[model samples]
Target: MMESMISSRIDIIKPSGIRKFFDIVTQMEDVISLGVGEPDFATPWHVREEAIYALEKGRTNYTSNSGLLELRQEISRYLATSYQINYKPETEVLVTVGASEAIDLAMRALINPGDEVLIPEPSYVSYSPCVILAGGVPVAVPTTEKTDFRLTSADLASCITDKTKILILPYPNNPTGAIMDRENLIDIAQVLRQHNILIISDEIYSELTYDGEHVSIAAIEGMYDRTLVINGFSKSFAMTGWRLGYAAGPEVLIAAMTKIHQYAIMCCPTISQYAAVEALRNGMDSVKRMQEEYDRRRKLLVHGFNEIGLECFEPKGAFYVFPCIRSLNMTSEEFCDQLLKTERVAVVPGNAFGDSGEGYIRCSYAYSLANLQTALERIGRFVARVKQA
Candidate 1:
């Protein structure tokens, strides 16, 4: 009886596939987890210090519904300097609980019932469910290893229907760590130009890009007005626990999202907002340091996976590596489960992201080199045993 009372939307979506393995890891001993995408680094010292200082000063009052003006200004300045896209702090930016909240807000504010949202799979697991909750149909456009997992112009053009309303562009992608370069975006933009779809560019991993500078689709000519840029301090500044992110887009959309935000969230954590102001103002150097370390680990894991016979692609952004496991003749879940039980290493199965990811597994390099090295050795043994079997 109680189950029937729950919303149909809530019932239809499965629990996060990432969390399912993580929960099992928590119950086991000696598991080296490369499953979660969170930064292994702590929030940068200065950012944490700012949060402590804010608490001491008793600045715990709720910020305006849109967010603290100071943090918004810093976000505006950071975007301008980093991505060459400009948004007015006063009207075009909305501070969200995290990029997660910004994503939900964008979906809720834009999606009408039956409107379709295009999501490229394998992607972060949230996109499809969020669209469903907001009464939108999610249309998956599959991308492959052939294109480095990018959503190509042909793919985008092929998926569009008259009902399609929004396209979620999650680059420096979670689970895959694939990034779309400027040339890639230019091609995607050319196709989007003929359509009237709005874009929600989830750029939370923007600062973690390893090859060249990260480019914002919003920065491309004729794309800015139609794109909602979502970014936060989590990945770059290692401020995942801070729960601060922002959305920059047109004033009309920002206002709509803010209205929903005001009713649902009221405001982001006050101390976190304050800390984020410092993160944007004084955090780039720390970001560069972390990026450098991630780059080192990235190379280590890619080489290790390939050496172990799991065809791994070199990721140019983010800290995860997606390695193909089809050669082992087992499913992604079967490989991950057996590896965890036998070798005590936890990595997410590729199918957790989407069906297209079924033959791959995502291993995060965010772990320490020592832990990663050990995990790689364990995985190597597991792969050998599986092959022998």
Candidate 2:
């Protein structure tokens, strides 16, 4: 009736900014949603077949708390071979229900009450709430479009305070599509070491980079011991619904995360773990192909935004584009609502991420080519009408 003596913190939590737009758009049956941050593709046939085969073979029961041994080993090998991220399957890896659970586990494992976790602004909405729910404080560090929305060493250095215990680094970031390159990562690592801050690097979109490559901060010397790497098949292999992901870090940190996960999560879905293993073993090709398609759409969106009078940075990774809508003289929310009301194209306002996101709107390019074309035209017309008004 009253959420069973719910904690005051829970009451203070706002619903996800990204999710709130869904209700508005869903009521309009004809609207095209470019709002959610997920791939539009289905899990590949081969991966799905593996899951079906597992269930058909009567493999429906629970697996180990960490995960099926084979899946953890496969993920260990995949990270090393693909991204040069070395992890020990036995002691350094823990599987959970998607990267979201991993984020929660990491916060619970590392944070003491009143500890501060630095999260970059305009990031996924979950970071701050999870920090607060774990009795930790969230210190938001703003990243601007001038830097391609990528968090830099200066930003990291400026945000570090004595109470800071963790930093959630969501790179190949959502909404902005910015990536931390080898150099930026190394510089940030230096600052982190200086402040003795632990890093929770969210690399779920590692496989989606259109830049040279996705480099894990954990791959740097000495950084591995201080970094918890969160990754999953959701973005890379189009397996969002399967709800499988894992974290790799030092044995001590990983063991703590495993303990929390064992009690709270038990294990990831068994069938999904089987499929994720297949993905790790032989799914690089699919990732490469999908990235190529995303690259094409990324270029198209950048060009379309510029032509339509919105200034946007070209995203080097991930599938979303953040376009500045201040020229319309309306807030991001006003712009998105007006566009949706008249043209039936749904997008998320930049402030959905953080206060720093006020004058922008995030449009995901995970849509089909035809849908993107139509959405862009509608947005263009909306811009023209706003100018005239």
Candidate 3:
């Protein structure tokens, strides 16, 4: 193979830091994994049943380039009902493989070479990589524990430049579980409105919010036109394997995304589309039940960490708890590695999310309370030993 055989585009980037530790865990036995940000719940029975019915009926063919119209319409209605944001199913929505694909589509469709994408630090691992792969420059704007990992307008404004093209907003954020309320969004919206930057708001964890309702920045005044709201059924409905997600945005952007999606994917899995329809229609009760369970785990983990001397911040949304491990006198990676090797509990190093995450580690509370209880006990022992040394 020639030196240039691999695209320089891909050669420049690094593999996900989240997966590095996870890969090690796969070969280990009796390890309790709090690393991956996946819901441990099975897909709701009704949602699974719907997918089975679709397969039984041989609904295995490809959908329209955008998606099954019925699924899109249901997504439209669900967003309207939940977030007060209206997205026309016909022209403003396009279903993709997952919110990951939706994020890529939005970036690729909107970016030009050398365009800067403002990404807040300690965000989902994929955001900056996707921006880079889309030929956009990823400018990481740091957010700190001092602000509960919330990206303030001041932080965002400081990074904007003449070359900035997009803002990747990942609230109900992955590692930190930080959320921006309506007032926080309004302040950020005010700053965004002054610039020509487009907003790619990844709200995949929207349904998992614990405090007030999840507010879409797209719903904020002056943001609708400039925002591409990315959401999907993976996190909310525990349908990660279903690979179904959709993007709601301006017609022109949607059209561009659909064009790329058509060429790249043609359509999402037809059976999954049917199941997503069921999810948006009749799965709210199931979602609520899961959310309630996650709330319990969230509270338990937050309190347990604080009590055990890790000093965790209370996360208002999502299933992960980020605990400050700086007192242990180790880097995030060293803390995670030592904990996993010694106690058989796997958690991700916070720096895997970004530089600002250096003093912390991300542990998902999506596991059962029993598993969480055991993991915490082991972690407590590990923390005590580290502190004494």
Candidate 4:
């Protein structure tokens, strides 16, 4: 009887595949987890100090429904300086609890019932479920290792239909760590130009790009007006617990999202908003330092996986690497489960992200070099045993 009270939409969505492994790890000892997609570093001292100072000063009142104007201004300046895209802080930005909230707001505000949202798989798991909850159809446009898991113009164009309302561009993608460079975006933009689709570009990992500077699709000539860029302090600034993110786009869309935000969220935490202001203003040097460390680990993990006979692609952004395990003749889940039970190393199964990720497993390098070295050794042993079997 209680089950009947739940919405069918809620029933249809699977629990997060990433969280499933972590739950099991919590019950076990000596688990070295590469399953989490969080930065292992502490939030920078200055940013944490700002939060502490805000608490000491008793500035705990709710900020504006749109968020603190000062923080929004910093976000505007940061985007302009970092990505060469500009958004008016006053009318074009709405602060939320995290990029997660910003994504939810965008889907709810833009998706009419039955409208389809295009998501490139394998992707961060939230995109499809969020679209479903907002009464939108989630359409998967599968990407492959052949393109370094980056979405192509052809695949994107083929997925569009008259009912298509939004395309979620999750670059420096979670699970995959694939990034779309300027040349790649130009090709994608050409296909989008002829469509009426809006873009929700989740750029949470923007600062973590290891190659050249990260490019924003919103910076493309015709994209700025239609693209809502979602970003936050979590991945780059290591402020996951602070729970602050924002959306920058046209005033009309921002206004619409803020309306939903006002009713649903009211405002982001006051202390977090204050800390985020400091993160944007003075914490970029800390981000650079963290990026340097992540790049080093990224190289180590890629090399280690390849040496162990897993075919790993070098990812230019983010701290995760998706190594193919097809040659082992087991499913992604089977490999992850057996590795965890045998070697006590925790990595996420790629199928947790989407169907296209079935033959891969995502390993985050956001761990100490010692832990990564040990995990690599354990994984190598597991691979050998599986091959011998």
**Which of the two, 1 or 4, has more lDDT?**
4
Off by over 4 Å in 3: 2-4, 16-20
RMSD to native, candidate 1: 1.1
TM of each candidate vs. truth: 0.98, 0.97, 0.98, 0.98
Name the Cα RMSD for model 2: 1.4
What is the clash count of model 3? Answer: 0
Residue-wise C-alpha lDDT for candidate 2, range 1-389, written one tens digit per residue = 67878878896677766565567778788887778788888888889999999999999999999999999999999989878988989999999899999999999888899999999988998889899899899999999988888888989888888999998889999979999999888888878878788999999999889858899999987788889999998999999999988899999988899888888878888999999988878777888888898898889988999999999898888899999998889999888888899998899999988998999999999988888998999989989999999
- How much lDDT does each candidate structure score? 0.93, 0.89, 0.92, 0.93
* Residue 68 lDDT (model 2): 93
**Candidate 1: residue 43 Cα off by (Å):** 0.7
Residue 238 lDDT (model 4): 97
Give the per-residue lDDT digits (tens) of candidate 1, residues 1-389.
Answer: 99889988897677876676667878998788898789999998898999999999999899999999999999999999999999999999999998999999999999999999999999998899899999999999999999999989999999999999999999989878899999999999999999999999999999999968999999999999999999998888988888889999999999999999999999999999999989888888999999999999999999999999999988889889999999999999889989999888888899988999999999998889998999999999999999998
Native-referenced Cα lDDT, model 4: 0.93
**Candidate 1 whole-model C-alpha lDDT, 0 to 1:** 0.93
Model 3: residue 340 alpha-carbon error in angstroms: 0.8
In model 1, which regions exceed 4 Å deviation?
15-22
lDDT of 3 by residue, 1-389 (tens): 78768889888698765676667788999889997788999999999999999999999788899999999999999999999999999999999999999999888898899999999989888888888898889999999988888889999999999999899899999989999899989999989989998999999999999967899999999999999999999999999999989999999999999999999999999999999999999999999999999999999999999999999999988889999999888999899888999999999899988999999999998899999999999999999998888
Model 4 is weakest, by summed lDDT over 10 consecutive residues, at: 14-23
